[model samples]
Target: MPWTLPSRPSRRSLLAGAAGAAGAALLTGCSGGPGTADPDPAVSLERRMRASSVRDSERLLERYDATAAAHPALAERLAPLRAAVAAHTSALSSSGASDGSAAPSAPAAAPAPGAGPAVSGEPVPPKPEEALAALADAERSLAESRTVALAGAPGELARLLASVAACGAVHAYLLTPTPGAAS
Candidate 1:
């Protein structure tokens, strides 16, 4: 047989190749286009809830600090509770981040005296007994809020919220004044 060089690909073959490439690009593009769109509603809501929880934790920590500072005797009791709030703030902040890394540590110093109320605009109690009652009330409120938040949170976040609720409940009990204690 006479030797023959292979002919270049035909126009039809080149057109078919280009068409296939275009179809593939279209299919992939349809999956996720370049436009910036909002995330799923559920995911957005969950993120907002996480941010709210972090803010609440920060306020609660500030309240604890103010109460402990005003009444030096209460400092020992409030220290652990404050630490727990800090940890909750840390976890909530980190878990909500896109990168899944821990947030920066909060400053060690507590807010200055008369900074603000723990929740709402109510003033911090002036007396020790009143302060403890206020703290307990705040803890109970936080626990309740956490319980509500858990229902909508994703699996890991739900678990974290539940644990935080349990801790808040315990803190509430510890803050409650004894029957015979001065009021």
Candidate 2:
């Protein structure tokens, strides 16, 4: 005989399921089976931003680990960036608005050539005297992301991402070197 679920569960049971689902959705958006209320677009955008931030941080950490392990000379400068990226990942994870995947595993730090004198990638390498320039670019893009997220994000998710975006702007500033200083 085919098993069939009860056509009508008790009201209390239904309410409990709803609350639990909501909580699960909040903690790990889309983790529950399909048909949950669509998350606000802003929330979706924020989740994307958080994921991007996590990835970027991981890359930075890998770079730092490689350089710190081999060159040691650049550790002072790269250490903070690595720490910041790790913190960014942590913040994104705790935002309670993640896309449900566990944080990306820390990659083995290979001696990938540092993003040299040339600017490569979206955020650009916050390095060589152009660090600030790179950060500005990242912030500008992140701002755009924030605007999108704000439009669709709701409640705590909006609040957290907004706060994180502000911090990202600050990070951009931090990445920039003082005037006339060698990179």
Candidate 3:
């Protein structure tokens, strides 16, 4: 059998191939990166979630401050947990998309210098035990919220939120004392 030379491609076929390639590139480039005319659906959603998480952490910090201020005796115990929450806030505040996908929303606003935790018409419990319980409840609630939010987050943000949520859950557990243990 004689080896045959390949035929020169037809202009019609070449133009069709180029057009298809261009269309695919345009579609691929149109992905919802931040600052695009048509933003990615998840990018904006992630930004909102991230901003909300940061604010939640900040608010929790306020609660810790208020609780400590109310019951000076518990300040030492709450210090580490409060510090962790602050770190969570910082982490979320600084998070940005690494996948060339997003710009996280603006950072959460700082609480006022003298501003105490937002009061829902209820003061910090007078008793230290009650105050600790209240703090634990806040931690648990926020952790639950964050966990629920994980489904909506992009990969990196989801991972960060998951870690923070787990930390919050741990904080809740630590705030409460073991009844069976001797003081």
Candidate 4:
């Protein structure tokens, strides 16, 4: 017998073969499918990040209020920045709602007198200058934390955090008095 090559597959056979391969892919694509993971890990993570950010902002607000009350002399300077932090809280709270999680409530007023840094449990200094410096330190710390958190935060949330962090940095700068400059 002549060593003749086998003929190519027919069109019908080719179509059938392709269909079978597609079906196989579909069957295996979702192997161990239902409830394999936490449904949606990304959403869960985002919710957590949002909640953390809210809580941090609230704590910062507390620190601000406490410092203001503890030293009324600085209250006027802190008012605008405090308002900005409150706005950030509201903004963060509203954004979390889109993910189906109820936003955390806004923070309450400052704690009892002589209660220092609410965020870090540190004592608020008695001197107005020291108190402002302490508040600035808290802002810097929180801003640094938020910046670190940017790594895992989702797109919109990351952007929000970054903006808030920048604002915090600004607040810190403003809170710290300039050297040899008039008050």
User: Which is the leading candidate under TM-score?
Assistant: 4
Worst 10 residues of 3 by lDDT: 104-113
**Model 3 quality (TM-score):** 0.67
Cα lDDT, all candidates: 0.70, 0.51, 0.69, 0.73
In model 3, pairs of residues that clash are: 32-40
Q: What ordering of candidates by TM-score runs from best to worst?
A: 4, 1, 3, 2
Ordered from best to worst lDDT, the candidate numbers read: 4, 1, 3, 2
Model 3 gets an lDDT of 0.69
Taking all chains together, each candidate's TM-score versus the true structure is 0.67, 0.47, 0.67, 0.70
Off by over 4 Å in 3: 1-39, 97-122
Please provide, for model 2 over 1-183, each residue's C-alpha lDDT reduced to its tens digit, 9 standing for 90 to 100: 998765544445634543443453355432435565675765676677666656654554454454443444556765665566566557655546356555534444444455333222233244334444544455545644653454445556555555555555555555555555475
TM-score of 2: 0.47
Model 4 pairs in collision: 116-124
What are the per-residue Cα lDDT tens digits for candidate 3 across 1-183? 997643633445544543443344344434536665554676787778878888788778778877776677777888888878887887787647456454433323333333444343346777778888899899989977876676656666766776777677767767767655574
Off by over 4 Å in 1: 1-39, 96-100, 113-120, 180-183
Error of 3 at 130 (Å): 0.4
Candidate 1 on 1-183: residue-level lDDT in tens? Answer: 997644544445544543443344334334534563565875777678788888888788778877876777778878888898888888877755568676655835765555545433567788888998898899889887877666556555666677677677767767775454484
Which model is ahead, 3 or 4, in terms of TM-score? Answer: 4
Tell me the lDDT of model 3 at 102.
42
Give the lowest summed-lDDT range of ten residues in model 2. 115-124
**Which residue segments of model 4 deviate by more than 4 Å?**
1-39, 95-104, 111-120
Cα lDDT for residue 94, model 1?
76
